[model samples]
Target chain A: MIATLLVVLQVVVATAITPLLIGVMRQVRARLEGRIGSGVLQPYRDVRKLLAKEPLRAEGSSIILVAAPLVLLVSSLLVVALVPLVTTANIPAVPNDLFVVVSILLIGTVALALLGLDAGTAFGGMGSSRHMMIAALVEPTVLMSVYALSIPVGSSTLSKIVVARGADVTRVVTPAGLLAVVALVVVVLAETGRLPVDNPSTHLELTMIHESMILESAGRDLAWLEVGSWLRLTALLGLVVNLALPWGLADSMQPLALLVAVVTLGVKLLVAGGVIAAAEVFMAKVRLFKVPELLAGSFVLAFLAVTASYLAG
Target chain B: MNPFRLLKLIARTGRIAEPAPAAPVADTEHPIPKALRGSVQVRHVDTGSCNGCEIEIGAAFGGVYDVERYGARLVASPRHADVLAVTGVVTHNMVEPLLRTVEATPRPRLVVAIGDCAHDCGLFAGAYGVAGPVSDFVDVDLEVPGCPPRPEAIVEALRRVTGR
Candidate 1:
């Protein structure tokens, strides 16, 4: 019963708090740029207005465009439910591994790309193709990064890895460990479509990558897409954070321990927000043609991390 | 990068130094109900203008004005928009796109004619290729009339529209 409740809570928080994270990041960016930005609750307001709107569908749009948002939303939420958020303890009977979670996330990306192609617009096509290219490059790096992290645990399951290494303070100090962290950070930035990969704030047609995919969707459909992306960000970042610093995750299904895990997760999220803001402010968006080189560099780092771990083993 | 500098900047912003707060959202006679009171996503259409009002519209949402705080945003797609912010006079060339965009916007929609050009065709009033005021094309809910309105005026008009 408690496990079920935790799963539900995780889903609710991902849905409700995801926008708040985006809002906080935006406010931090504005402050960094020496401009007064909107309130941190601005995203909540945006979501509210969006949910209330009547959705508009494009002419000649197929079922792919119509259903992609819902699929993306469900897929993202499923990943959230599977991944350990407040606690590392496996929920009752729901089981998930690093590979399974990664696959689920990729499915969401593919659905979005399909929606972009189905829209039949120049911008949508451009965004979809570019997004697929980025995803194809990023996924392998993500897998390699996770592989390096999972090396110490000897088991591919997320819960087991957390249980085994949650208290290992020396885990991230090694050469391989550091490389894995760097690779994951790069993947997080790329996956979230932030600066140095794609700018989320720009509305200019020529500069868009992610925005163009949903440029044709409006009203409630757009809201669902936004919600899904935010949840995906939270899930990916949660994995990165928990993998690196799994110390506070609840080892057993205890309510008190779960509460502590929640608190720790909140601190980690705030730190993540600050880190993302700094990265956005300091790093300029690279040229589109150079993006492959950046992703390739991340993959190379992941490869080295895995090789170093193998040699050490 | 200093933590102290970051904290200090946050602390200084806490003084309510910005947002000028003169929009009277608190005292508005008709409150925009909690649900609808949050944000206004705008889809700006340039029917036919010299790009003068466009600059003013940009200023209205820019950092100095910061319409974001008031929960108003400029969206790229008309489908995601709540307000059709039409600028300048409508031209024969833009009639189809203007109508298509308005049709694309979902229901419970509102239209704002920004600048005198959009209101009564302004300087382009009897010019060839002109399709008359935005009202003749689509019903305008509110009008922000000026050769080009100021950023605050635009923000204030939006505040009225949002009823906050």
Candidate 2:
């Protein structure tokens, strides 16, 4: 019963906090540009307005095309439920390996991208192709980085990784751990479409990857896409925090401990958001051709970390 | 020197000055009125384009981009829309549907023109069947331009509509 309650809380919190994280990044970006931005709750308002609008359908859309977005949202929510936030005590975390979590995320991306192609528009097909190429590159780096950390813990379970790191402070300071951190940072950048991988800000046709896939949807459908992206940002950040920070993860079901854990996680996420915004400000979008080199570098770093950890052990 | 501090100052100072009131009562938080509760009603119309933007927009609402949490939703009829978001370019084939959408929607409506096709004609610019621009059909308040903009950008544009 307690576990069930925690799972419920996890979904509620993930849903609620996702927008705030996006808001913080926006606020940070606006501040860097010397402009005051909208309130963090502004996303919530936009979503409300969207829901009240009517939906329109295109002529050529098939059952698969219409159902794809619903599946994408459900899959994302399932992943959010699986990922323990605020407290590890609520969910039985072992069934979900890092590989499994990453795969589910990829499934969501692929499903939506394929739906883009199903739309039968030239841009949709073009966007779908580019999105797949990027995903193909991203998957290996993501797996390799998690494997680097998983080796040190002797298990790929997210909870175990966080628990092992929390129980043993000496592990995180090691050379292998440092390299893994570096690789994970890059993966976050790539997965979230942050600058130096794919810039979310740019509208230039030659550069976009994720944006191209969604050129046809509007109204409430667009709103769901926004919320999902925010949840994704939260989930990725959760991985960075739990794996890299690993401090204060609740080991018990006690309410107070869970509360403290939630606060700690929030602080960590906000800091990451600020750093990302700052980094985006300082960096230009990596040229599309250079993306492969960047992912290759990440793979090498991850490979080195795994080898180093094995040798040290 | 924290960025939030600088932005708040800038936005606050940018506010237009108005006549003084007898008592200045400030509302610290924006209220989620009862009317905005539950699902948000939406009307989506494709002006014209290759169809990539529509797929992404559809994906946003499905399982991945679930917009339901914000008490908003997409309604099938334009008469129900408080928000009107149009995708694709304004093509000759789509002008009737686009205009019909504008006429069907009520007053004080928010119009979001998503994707580069809708914004600046994108790759569909010179096509003979295209109606040229969306502004020719309906008043668009927000333009989310990309070959297809990311869901994150689309949501940001919507947030601006609510004045939240």
Please list the C-alpha lDDT of all candidates, in the order they appear.
Answer: 0.81, 0.70
Which structure among the candidates has the greatest DockQ? 1
- What is the number of residue pairs that collide in model 2? 43
Local error of candidate 2 at A271, Å? 1.3
Candidate 1: which pairs clash?
B25-B164
Candidate 1, B73: how far from true, in Å?
A: 1.1
Q: What interface root-mean-square deviation (Å) does model 1 yield? A: 4.0
Q: Which candidate is the best by lDDT?
A: 1
